[model samples]
Target: MPAFVLLIAALALAFLLSRLLRLLAQFRRIQRIPVSTVALLPGSGQAAVTGNASGAQLSSPFAAIPCVFWSIEVQEYRSNGRSGSWRTVLARTSDAPLVLDDGTGRVQIEPAGAALFLQDRFAAQQGMFGGLNQSTLDALERLGVRTRTWLSTSRRLRIRERQIRHGERVFALGEIARAGAQAALASTPDAPLLLSNRDAPALARDLTMRMLGLLALPLLLLLAALLIGVFG
Candidate 1:
């Protein structure tokens, strides 16, 4: 309502706009690359490969489920009565090469530094009323992360796990790297790899929806600013 409030809002919107524009640019770049199978992959260039994930699986730390890739995050809710926020206590990810088979061929791809888009396999919260299962609690304790504390009433623990399971369809985008007789899809400085469980079309749709949502907020803010300037 005040001039200072408007100024702060304007600055915030500008910052958000910069981030959104960068994401939009990345979305365009990904959309332009055509999806290719492992067999039809070219000798050299950027590539988008679709195939089924296969290989030795990692045991998820929190859930202990078998997966080609797994990521677990634990956050603790901290509050000062007036405000509250979730603070990450621990985060872990499995970094292993997995085999991708597109029926025509198979390629080994590394998972490090790749942007993963997979559905969460498990998500739950732990509080005074309820807590994570005993096995999970034991695992966390082994990791030296104490889920229970003297101030448990004022704090809550939350955990979530995401995984890429074996035999699941996966989409990978990056440049091709050759090692002797084998070729692998990998990330470059300019073109980082992206791995997702969704197909190309579905992934594109999701990106489009996110971009639209980002654009909508800025437009609404601009319109509101205009109305305030005219009638204030």
Candidate 2:
């Protein structure tokens, strides 16, 4: 009995340790990107109307608003035609600006211009197809080439071609947070950083839970082994 209890405690401890290690790894692996501003948009009325018939408020008013401290991964790939480099930055929220790393500096691309750039760049580069889904592709196509044309004339569309490996995470913040973070940036910072979100506590908690679950896997296996030994 004592051995069994000891084993249980050991399993729990192992699980916790595993979870901690995984969380640490994820934290170290995530790459954060900073932006100058963030904007919020109204949630789609159409989605809400179609989503629920109970009038249960298909979407929260805050759903459309962009929050600070969000993240995405930026991937750069060579154009199929070899005309120019193409970049794909994935975000959970579409209301925010695109991130740009210009070697010497980083900037938040205006949403309109960014959309245009993506549209034109994608269209020009053999339909701009990569990891995008049908919905995303449709959205990009609908966005058209007007804004990108304007941006090309104004800003140098020179993006340094770089590879972003799979599973790399990038972080972004709202305009206010970006401004604050920019002011706080020192010369030769170690890792990329973005503005901290006021609501980050919830996200942190969620991430912690995920890490804990990952840690529990080993414990579960051990328990299964113990149960089989006892029953058999």
The number of clashing residue pairs in each candidate reads: 0, 2
Model 2: per-residue lDDT, tens digit, 132-155?
A: 334433443343312133345321
Best lDDT goes to which candidate?
Answer: 1
| Estimated TM-score for each candidate | 0.83, 0.27
For candidate 1, write residues 1-232 as lDDT tens digits. 7899889888988887886876676677678989887788999888888899987768888878888888788889888899988999998778788788999898877777776667788987888576778898887888778876786643488888998889999988878887568778887777677888999888878778877888898789789879989998
Measured with C-alpha atoms, the lDDT of residue 39 in candidate 1 is 84
- Candidate 2 residues lying further than 4 Å off, grouped into runs, are 1-22, 25-198
What is the Å distance of residue 231 in model 1 from its true position?
Answer: 9.6
Model 2's C-alpha root-mean-square deviation from the true structure amounts to 18.6
Clashing pairs in 1: none
